[model samples]
Target: MLRITDARTGDPVTATPARRGLTRVEARVERPDATGLRVLLTADVLVRALEIGGTPVWTVLTGTEDRAELRARARALGIRPFEDERDGGPGPGLGEAQVLRVCARTDEPAGGLCVEVAPADIENGVALDDGSATALRLALLARPRGTELRLDAADLADAEKQLKHWRGAVAGWATRPSGPIPDPVRDQLRAAWEDDLDVPAVLGVLRKVETSGTVPDGARFETYAYADRLLGLELTRDIGRGTPA
Candidate 1:
């Protein structure tokens, strides 16, 4: 079972009814090796209240050391890191850093994505129904590509459909939920659903592309490369194929 805890207090903060505050959600998945499992966690702002004045909080992210550790961990599990494509074309920018941040904190299984939302990302005092919607959407646009794995075509298609459906459902629930949705997460999700260009469609096509056998097993890095190409194509189409600033 996945457990969430307050990173600072180490107390039970996740299960509590949604309250306006800074919190982290910790995900613990069973390890694949059976010898032991790997764990991963990320920090996100749980927008509990919209009307309160609070201190500015910052998320601490490490580089160099954690990156090396996570790379080794993924290798041990027979999973490869996404290839570094910044030298030429665009790739999952900052995604590696985010992944490393999450993996360094826990030992969990593979196949899940985690995101962090900081307090600075949240804009208080704005009505949720107003233009804050677009602000939130742009926030997701700014987020780096999450995972770059070679997925089975069928699996990719299924994940795409599931993501689309989840986006719609979550958007509707955001307006009024019998329960509560963290404000920060709610905004980011809604934005991704509304403005993210062709994420699902790109994944769907990638499924078919991978099955052509051009990318071999044990070559997961190539999967990232392919995903980047698909993303570039989609973005190009979105911006008339011109250079993306």
Candidate 2:
């Protein structure tokens, strides 16, 4: 089960509004038997943890941050001065220093994650070639407090595939419903769908029965009262629970 947060208030939200813009959303995913699993969708990072034996693997791709940022990143990964350096020995410049590059291990078989780099910064001691320097920030964001941090590389081709499938499914929903839908009641249900308050299976039923390129403005409001009421009740209950819907 999961609860999505309202981007502004941090309160739980059920659906993505078609009109009202969300500042952001973080998915609080919980499995009854699994603990410490979290999914965050933000302006910068959109990563999902895929695990086998409780080991999380994430694929990342972005082209931001500067050379200074990369150097800072190197330091964060435990890169240190050479042991042979004397008290005042000359410090190695960017060209010679090594930065710990990280890659999530899950996506390797799926054609790999294509992470971009600031190609111009390569000469500035920033190891933009591997692009793993940003992993620590993303990992820490998703890691639960008190958990030991462990990083690895993985494949992420599945991410694009999954997104494509979702888009395709949504596109199919653009067609109108077979029959008529009274305006007021459909307005209510559409609101519910926009709010993610209605049970998905029920919406599927409406879509099949209405067949008229969506809901009609007004036909039989009385006929849909029961369905409308049920969805409203469900929405109310979800709001009260403030956890899962």
Q: Each model's TM-score, in the order given?
A: 0.22, 0.19
lDDT of candidate 2 over 5-90, digit per residue (tens) = 33234354432222222212112212210111111111112211111112222222222223244334334432221121122212
* lDDT (Cα, 0-100) at 46 in candidate 1: 18
* Model 1 spans with C-alpha error above 4 angstroms: 1-41, 45-55, 63-155, 166-245
Q: Tens digits of per-residue lDDT for model 1 on 1-245?
A: 11233233434222222233332223222232211112221122111111111312222222223445444443433332333212311112331211112332333222223322221222234332222222222222233323222223344344334334333332332233233323433343333222312244334444443353542332322332323332222111222222222
Winner by lDDT: 1
lDDT of 2 at 39: 17
Q: What is the lDDT of residue 213 in candidate 2?
A: 50
Give the Å shift of residue 172 in candidate 2: 13
Give the Å error, residue 24, model 2. 0.8
